[model samples]
Target: MRQDAGNRVPDRLTSLLLGGALLLLPALALAVSPEPKTFRDWMAGCDNRKSCAALSLPPLVADTTAYLRLERPAGPDSAASLILRLSGDWKTPPATVELKLDGTPFPAAGKAMPVTANDNIATLTFQPADTAALIDAARKATKLSIAAPGLLAEISLSGAVAALLWIDEQQSRLNTPSALIRKGSAGAAPAAPALPVITARPASGTLSEKGGKALAAALRKHIKQRDPDLCGDDASPAVADEAWPLDGKRSLVALTCSLGVYNASNAFWIVEGNAVTTAKPVNFPQNDGGATNMLTNGEFEPKTGRISYFAKGRGIGDCGVAGGYAWTGSSFVLTELSMMGECRGIGSDDWITLFRSEVKTAR
Candidate 1:
């Protein structure tokens, strides 16, 4: 049926809008895609540099403590690295482990796999060829088991496919051969982006014991007046407020903000000369792209201008948020930050790296 010019133009405009929306579907999905997304039994996260890592979690068995970390940086030439780490309460650490797929012995995949062992931790790094094969099998297999005489770690591959596919999506390798889940004969992906760098200024000057106490007290009073709602006095005042000299006229002070059973928050400030009125909260860069002043169980090192914070998830400190910063005279920059959202008995040092920077301190 022939239509009028006005009707034809409206129909054409609707068609164009729908076509554009179809083309933008993928980008729209990615725009709101959650970083550190959880896919069933697995968790995947990509850093700012498009360096993706997927962590595998084993079944919740007290005796079994092991997981796989599949990491690949964004680049055509970059290859995937798979590390299987095992460390938990056991009679003795296993010297080696055998691979199994769906309850069957998988010696072919384990052949020539590099093994590193110590008293507490044992790790196996799969070869590049084996890593490719392992990823292929894991995407389809139900379970991949790492077993020894007394140790066994059963990793469920429920969402292995999705997690790997998300990594490929984040790295723009969806249809390329570099993709872990989906592979095609597409051309090379873009090179890995350069890392962010942070230059640290060394803190100087000295603070006597009495001077430190007085500075802390003044800063505490100033904070109470400035942000009274923040750090109401808790009964646990045993942990004394601390102060470190940042420079000749400026000093950094930490007042015990709040205390918990397993964690403590410290309010930091930079005070100039003896003017406590000039004290302000330390503007620390946060991982989520903002500035914060609170640090949990933090301490400062004057020589290196380093300040670190470690908030344990539990008393055992198996999982939590841990990071450090390097002072840049005017502000503190985050050098590294990682988080273990789950307290799955994983070591504190094993948290997933979310943000990292090339830190350069004064020589």
Candidate 2:
């Protein structure tokens, strides 16, 4: 499972003793939309354009994956529903499963469905209210465990809060549906600070000498500290003629290192605050039978608030691709991609003229 990298949100919300009360609560109606926006931990999408959101948990020593999804159909929908999808791995599936949050039984307004197997899927459906309860439990608890006749597994509640916040942001519900999301809700979820606004500068036709010197210095420092074997000197004549401001305080510097005419590598870095930190370097294809990195010609678009780069295809007939990444508070996300005819050369104009396909996230 992929790990989330950021300051951990504390679980401070209090939970009600609703094990019995929830059984009598009614469901809440909700909506789903087609191709809705998504974050790292949450997804908002329609199986076709209604209001739906989903949270997936990394399994803990389980053979199958698990998902918690909420769906509210369009207008006049009586109630929203929460559904659980589990991987089927049992020989004799259980008829019911109980959920626990932080060692306490979680309230459920509806009964769990019998474990149905379709190929390898196990499904459980609950009334919309139950889904709301589960989401709330997740926010305030450290762990969530599912218990069944022959299965027992738990999920760490590390990313649950962010996932739910993403959902609320999409619907503009402001936590109206679940008390857990409200300011005074039992969870008492702390308001997350706004992400630093990263603005881009108007593209300058050329890179400044100061920027080039900074880039070369940063790369040499990185090589000396991280990979002395690949680079013998930090004073090599590396140049960064291409520079783009990522924001008022940060910049992106593109650089290339050539081993020879047949061996070369290209990479870029993010200069954060006033310091340049070690960055992940990308390797480009060389004529000397080496694996190639597709990313090149990195630039930041001020109007779109996105960083883009040219990417060449690996396969002989594959098209050239343009990739764009959006800045999340903590990291970058690949949110835009475009494909064109074969990339005969990284800078060939013919490739751009032969646009084939594109997909972009709705900003």
Candidate 3:
């Protein structure tokens, strides 16, 4: 997939949970705001003094990057404008100047504007029709780049300005309060304060071999309850893996459920979390002793980084299988399990595989 940086919205669920928390608790939310002492403010200050040339102009070079920052004031009828303070040496003063709004070429109407010799600064006033579309386009841009056909040097944008612009646009729609409330009535309940959202870190510490055996034992017990034939006297083609690094802080444990008869396997990794734990499972494709095929499905948990699933086998080689490791801090909890290696004279057949895994903090 072609990665479009601008089009990517950070994972939706993560955004929702984080955004909800911020909306509910503004004070504690991460705020993006512009600084009071900015280039725009400096320009305005200089203009008020009626001495534009007094401001020192920053140098601009050809094929170099440059840009201006802007923020629309909050409110519906706020005046829109694109203000750029140009600074650079002009080799050949072009007869006419052209402005591109949001990467779209704009039609030039006026003659070339003169740049002040002392300050090398020039301001281009955009018309109303141009301002609206420009403002709208700017609000959607995470990063803005500006260029003049033959200008050089680079410009740096302040994050603060970008943040302020975003805030202004976001608050614009809520400029007026609703008038549907009853006369002299108190408003609806106040919004809840936002809460801090934290993701659970993987567990640390060394996993006890004994504990791994015990977890596998517990899983086998659970599996037996569902299908008595699934667990035999010996470890039923299923093996367990664990990660317990020397740090002794976090760990991972997994149970491999393999269907030897059908040539398929599914491995489930149990992870640790602060409140609720999770599991990660991986599936593997099964090739017939040269005859059957296989398919599988699974689920993933973003917050805790876990996946889980079951596999079914059919058509000599048709079966579901998966296997993968869960990163548990210092070491990896690896697993490899599958089904469908043993097959006699072929015939279409079916088999069902079911399994589950859970995450719990180290006790």
Candidate 4:
């Protein structure tokens, strides 16, 4: 559930509906990496390294909680990992886990998987061989039955096969013996790709509370003058401005731009853009197909010099966008991020990880 951050290609591509036929367009690039795919009740996606995840969609029945995540790194010999979680009034964590495929016990006729408790969550581990067995079991199973302490649910396997197959194709494991669902002697999938590296300058410098308030107000006025449509009378009356030094000469500034009933958007820029330096907007990491420079509910941290934002799509907090960036001295770099596409009933706390990176101070 935690990752450095990734560019999640939109889950579903836009298709134009014709009178009687569906018109398809070329696959476009929304971000640097591949897009996540939706099949039935499953979502599958992979990062730059070919490491991929196939997750079970939430139940259609509102107010029900059941989720399963299958993750595997790219390579010919990779280990499979499974994380099963649920949200409900289940008093205590389950002591054992049991699974059935198509109403029949699998992996073991009647044996139960031991569960470990941690922070009120249950855990189940499986060996690579066991994972292989489960994948093989899923090939013909129509429904996945899960049982545990204070938890009992049946997750649809309708799209499970398609999702896993998609992952195989994405990781170049399709038709290869290494593939989870598809199998062939074609060859092993290429090694997992390395994550992109971002060398950032540690965040530094802080303005006095009064200086910060003053400069923030000034910047807000400046932005309003330059882009009235972005911060006009119709925009939020309240303004916010915060500054953090990226270097001795230039600093990063964030100011309030627009506001919604449930979210407030902030704009970021280089503090002193003028005859000496042109003030330009900084594009932050995003996956929700929104503006990068203007983040909703954005905040700049002085301690880490990192800026993060969370945009709630609704007041109930069922869905929205969330991400953080590190100052690279020259620009903000995406460090950690996650997103939940549909509000449905999925908790806001479980944004899917699209991209992740290993960041080091460039100094």
- Which candidate number would show the highest TM-score if scored against the true structure? 1
* lDDT of every model, 2 decimals: 0.69, 0.43, 0.31, 0.63
lDDT of 2 by residue, 1-363 (tens): 222222121111011111111011000112111223334444343221223344443432344455565554323222456666665456766667777778777664333445555654566886656666676676667776777876776656666666556545444444453322543333322332222233323432333567656665665676667766443443342643345555565555555543222222345556654365545433322222242222344555644545565433332212234444554433344443333322211122212221111233333
State how far residue 250 of model 3 sits from its true place (Å). 71
Using lDDT as the measure, what is the rank order of every candidate, best first? Answer: 1, 4, 2, 3
RMSD in angstroms between candidate 1 and the native structure over all alpha carbons: 13.3
Q: Candidate 3 — which residues are off by over 4 angstroms?
A: 1-66, 69-78, 91-95, 101-103, 107-119, 139-149, 152-363
Which stretch of 10 consecutive residues in model 3 shows the poorest summed lDDT? 45-54
Between candidates 3 and 4, the one scoring higher on TM-score is: 4
Which candidate do you rate higher for TM-score, 2 or 3? 2
Of candidate 4, the 10-residue stretch with the lowest lDDT total is: 19-28
Write out the backbone clash pairs for model 1.
Answer: none
Candidate 4 error regions (>4 Å): 1-31, 62-64, 118-120, 232-239, 260-262, 273-278, 285-291, 315-318, 344-351
- The TM-score obtained by model 4 is 0.81
Kindly list the per-residue Cα lDDT of model 3 for residues 1-363, writing each as its tens digit: 011122111212111111112101011011211112223211111111111110111222233212342333323334434444443455643233455433444433422333332234445555566545444454443333344456533333224233333333233322233111111233322222222222223434445667656655555556556556533334654453232322343233344343344333333434342111232322222211121111122333333433333332233232223332233333222222222111211111211111112233232
**TM-score, one value per model:** 0.85, 0.36, 0.25, 0.81
Clashes of each: 0, 14, 39, 8
- Expressed as tens digits, the lDDT of each residue in 1-363 for candidate 4 is 221122122233222221222222121125435556778878777765667787777664522356667887888888678766555546676788788878788667667878676654555666667777777777777777778755786777778888888888888888887777878999788887778777656666655666656665666666667766755444344445566665556666777655556666667777652211355677654334433576667787655667776656455564555666777676676775555555444554445656667777654
CA error at residue 173 for candidate 3, angstroms: 5.8
Cα-based lDDT at residue 78, candidate 1: 86
